[model samples]
Target: MNTQYTDSKIRRFTIFKRLLNYEHLSYQQLSEEYFVSRSSIANDISYIKKQFAKEDLSLTFDNSGTFFNGNEIQVQKLMKRVILQREEVMDIDNLLMNQIANVFHEAIEKREIDIPESHIENIVLSIYLIIFRSKQGYTIKLDGKNQLGRLFFEFDKYPIVYDLLKEVEKCGIYHFSTDEAQHLTYLIVGSGLRFFLKDEKIPFSFRDRIAILIQKVSEGLRVNLTQDNRLEEDLVVHLYQLFLRTDAQTTIVNPLISEIKQTYPSLFGVVWFALSDFCKPYQINLSDDEVGFVAIHFQAAVERLKKKNKILFVCPNGIGTSSYVSAKIRRILPDINSIETVSTSKLKSMDLSDVDFIISTVMISEQRKPVVTISPMVTSKDMKKIMNYYIDLIIYNEQKITEKFEFSYETRELIGKDIIFGNFSTKKDALDYLFKRQDFSDELLKEDFISSVWEREKLQSTYFDNGFAVPHGNPAFVEKTAISILILDKAIPWGNQMVDVIVLLLIREEDVEKVEPVMNLIMQGIEDKEWFISKMMEVRE
Candidate 1:
């Protein structure tokens, strides 16, 4: 091969692309084609290899020609990036999607299959991999002699499945068996975004289960999440695919697992508690990857339920840059309702009362409100500045919401050192232990206070965040107005939430006004959960 070349970087990349596309170009042919000597051609190839090395790509030269030696999947990903970003549609132009779209359109129009625009990529990738593997002669038994095979058998003959297989055969030399086509059908249907249209009806049992799951999580997190039908619809689609993947013993690669776990630990904990049992029936280990994906859905829903803010953009760099900065803000922070821009001269004169905060290109001389200063272009530094402020504001706002329920009550009557219990397991055991410690009037028993508390717990748990479960009955059922603190010896699983601290309320019928204040106290516990949990654990009898 040639070892010398001219200093042209673009020519090197062009040669590299040709090398990837064709393996028959010899050193002599390339040297003549590029009007360079044999040594210059080698130098160009060497330069190409250096560039490839930076991208984690490799090249080899042999008697035939230059060969791209890399993992096929990694190479495919690199090709997709180059074609989408660098070429900018001078190349493929989404031809793969268009091809598959043609096949899916008929089934979709006929209502034999429902496909969502959001999941077109998944469908395309599924078909691509199935065809690729089938060409390599990968086979699975089609007949339902086994339990798992029955799922395929039920759908193998469906008109939609047969049509897709026939269409796929047109693009390749390989033929798909009925069983393989059925597998593709399940993958497409289960993972498609049809749920967003809200026309698809899931099974009653599945719908009920998802509703209960969301409701319990909502109760656990102290938020109203029932109205978000999108969340329910997405989970149904996700869980259906999850079940199929589990049955096939396949694992998913979640790119955002680390980020999600770090950003939303409490929400991650809530999701784990909610879905751990749901995985038991399928007998599959609930993986962190799956949890991360589920957490993303919940995080989006929570963000939607948050209060939107109005912002002011201060850019001395002119309207064009200010508009670009505003677009970036809207992209990063969907919670922003409106943003009004101003020049440095108008900074002090601007009506700032309606704005929640200010993002400035230059530092404000006077600090009247919260201001985040970044360059006009908006970089990651700006992202952090905006994100940190919102996070702090979120904590502050949460505390403000709890403030209304906080009041000075000197009578820590039922919350003294004597009323706290140190050891308990099940809810039944915890209740029995509490009952043994006190002698109540017959009126409380006649109202079935204990039975009512037990029954209420069955319907929905009283467990909120910070390892505290607030359990109480109707004021009418109570004979005494008291607060009982039950600190467990260890955390016990309490209806999808673990509990190490139990605060029992036994308010008298007339003193029912105290519940809100007590709940505010629980919110305070959540503010410093570690400290609260430590205090509960160390409380001695």
Candidate 2:
């Protein structure tokens, strides 16, 4: 909210930039340069050290001065983080960002390159930093031994990427070395860019891998998606892009990852599990952002497979009221393709087999189809009721397997004395506490369980946006199903978001079916966090 930077912030930003450029200045020199006291300069250096610490780098002091101790890649990464965090402070050049973005668009339009719109900004930012750092005589040098480094050295293999770099060279007014050009190439291609050449071919094995992914997900969700040709085609392309990103050790930050995880918690988890299995054989590790992107394709396929609702309206009063209500309903919900209106007298004789649900002005005795009653003149309350019914209907139609997800006795029993209330400063502390409380069986190895949990966390953070985190290990490491709840006295950073409530979900392979309902309950809690936390307090009592 504070657009104006304080003197301290500006001084710190200047020092960060100088240090990023590998400058070493003592406290006295910085104090004289910034017109500040030696103590103020010391504070600035201390702040800079903390920032480096966050990135897992150390700022060392020697006879010369204090400097960041890292390699070229680490320096570049730290620069990016600092620039993004202090964008306003740095007064980033909008013209430069836009110029770089225009070059990418031009390349994409000319068919010289292809990339998803989501990653255009990533490339733009990286190039912006490259130009800035390169101009200052700091150039990236790739290590020859690593996979990415090897790919970088053989950059000419991707002729399209090499050509694109030439165009980028003109925009930045800098002749990039093999290492720099290849680094840019990796970014362009890894950010979901597709290379199309007349003689190029997609291997059959690649498509086979996608098929296995679909089959695994289909079996888990009990939905037959293998027959969907569109899903297969979409996934083939997406997985190729995924493979590129994974190989390059980079991924596009998915802005909708939180929403996707929250809205379709079960589907998201299933996709994560299925994709994890899919990537394992290839020894590829994907970020949660990638999983979220893949989940979107499957979620889209689910939407496509859903049956459009057909509503039957019954009004005993008159035809005018029925027509008006039907028109209103149609306006409110465009997804309903069919709406048949009839009087109460004719309703009994009409075929209910085709109707998914019945919306009536008067209460109708139990018909086979689900019935909802509303006033002849639809009020806001009535509209809300109708929308709620429609949402539940679509969710039911979309995921038929989750039809029986009500809070029953078993659901209550799943959350018992494991409820904990404490203050944890970090995600690891919260997870360590919850893991300690769990009663692991003889069949379960604690090390394996801990490793799987952290591994999953590394794959993608379990922190949801509802001030809660649901951390779980591989189900194979568990002998029983349990949901350990931890209500933090204060919220802690779990990953990208802050979590006040932590739900450590542990389950066995046999209880895989329970994932959906349990996730549904957590999602419901997220919708009304205050009420959920209050209820949690009562349980603690």
Candidate 3:
């Protein structure tokens, strides 16, 4: 049989032996005697009672106490079988000791402390060896100074030994004293070592010590194994406290956010956005640092939300088919926030500057923000397309911000035969040509094509110089493809600048995937002042 199975049998036998010894004891008393929880004791007692019943061995329990009347020899024989099956349990303890040694070795290699890896590993192994042998009924002898000797004997107490062993078994890291006697015992446990943490009583305040201890333990466990209970509890509590007192806006300023920024700055923007949304109900103000912390939580929450199909609904014109649209959206989106309804006139007038994405029945002309428009007769197919579009946009924006920025070499690198460049005399002229063309099959780009591109420009002026306005998608709202270059004979009012050279990129949903490869090229075209001016000067109708 597998050694793990044998170890399990031994554990079961140990529980059974303890139960047999205290057959008359109440479950609560048994729990105390075994140093296990009441539930564990009850479970063990229940299993033992079942076994007795299976064999037709009489057993009774009540207020008068419990008794077992059966073949004593047979009971002893069964107990021996369990004991024999558990012989490998001792080996498991030894293996755990060795695992501790390896952990210390790794920590040392990382140059975490001045202590030598070999020395730490040996010391931990020795300590565990002593404990393991002793647990197997062997006496341990120690020779060291009085303080060290006292620590070793105190460590032998069942409660302390059990606590330490349980921690090592569960967490794969045993924190023990580094006194000479304890070190010697640790060295003996190397054969069975799993991992070990030698307590370092450094010259620091209590709070500092706690922080240091938690850091060390978390680092060790995070690398050698999955995060343990202690780490999860500590991290979650730290985040909770950081967010608890913070208002939605200032939550981005926490130290945890700063740490994440240092490691991942690009993710900082998306994370900040998520934290802002999360803290919305609490009305907490977030700082950059707090935003970083919230980003981590947001990433985790989103992963879970994806599996559950969570969604939010937005509609313009509350009076029409908005309710029906909301119901259809609810069927597709899990964790659905209430469907929000706003009038088209109100939508056009109201500042939806901070809204995530708007889904509307009525098409508002001034959609200067992120909005997904659907017809009043929106069908299931329309819902699917809109949901997919929104989800893709969110994902794309996140990817864009997270990617590293690169410099482009020239304008020709991005604008070529497949990509055209020109300037428009008026926004109307540019709008007319882009929508009127039937060269492309993508309808989303053809329908309201001018407004969508113009909306992006309105968010921020795309003009890079006196003659150039590089109007492109927020890289978040693109659905279907086309890139247009319009050269205007005269300057026109574009956002905050007058422009003669306009490079309007019409990108399809699929083309957005190429943003990474062509990003540098686009940036290069915008940055070349002389080339951009030259291109504008040479533009024709």
TM agreement with the true structure for every prediction: 0.42, 0.67, 0.27
Clashes of each: 4, 0, 76
Scored by lDDT, model 3 comes in at 0.44
Among all windows of ten consecutive residues in candidate 1, which has the lowest summed lDDT?
Answer: 144-153
lDDT of 1 by residue, 1-541 (tens): 2333243555566676666554556779877776777887788877665544423346766887777754433343344334323443223425654666676665466655555554455456555544543444444333443243343224533455466567667765347766566555555545543532244355677677778778756764667888999999878777766665444333344667665644555566567555643444333445556777887888789988976788888888877898899998888888777888888787777767767888888877866789888887688988889988978877887656434222343334335544464777787788767755654778547348777666556644566545777676654677767777777778886764567878776766455334434544555565566655554444423
Identify the leading candidate in terms of lDDT: 2
Question: Which residue ranges in model 3 land beyond 4 Å of their true spot?
Answer: 1-233, 236-320, 334-339, 375-378, 405-541
Q: Each candidate: RMSD to true structure?
A: 17.9, 7.2, 28.8
Q: If the candidates were sorted by their lDDT against the true structure, best first, what order would they fall in?
A: 2, 1, 3
Name the runs in model 2 displaced over 4 angstroms: 1-71, 74-87, 94-104, 112-114, 144-156, 170-172, 197-227, 246-291, 313-336, 339-345, 350-408, 422-471, 486-502, 520-533, 537-541
Candidate lDDT (C-alpha), each: 0.61, 0.73, 0.44
**Candidate 1 local distance difference test against the native:** 0.61
What's the CA error at residue 382 for candidate 1, in Å? 17
Cα lDDT tens digits, model 2, 180-261, are 7767766776664345423444578778988988876776566788889999988877776566555444435666877776
The positional error of residue 95 in candidate 2, measured at the CA in angstroms, is 4.9
The model with the greatest TM-score is 2
What's the residue-level lDDT of 81 in candidate 2? 60
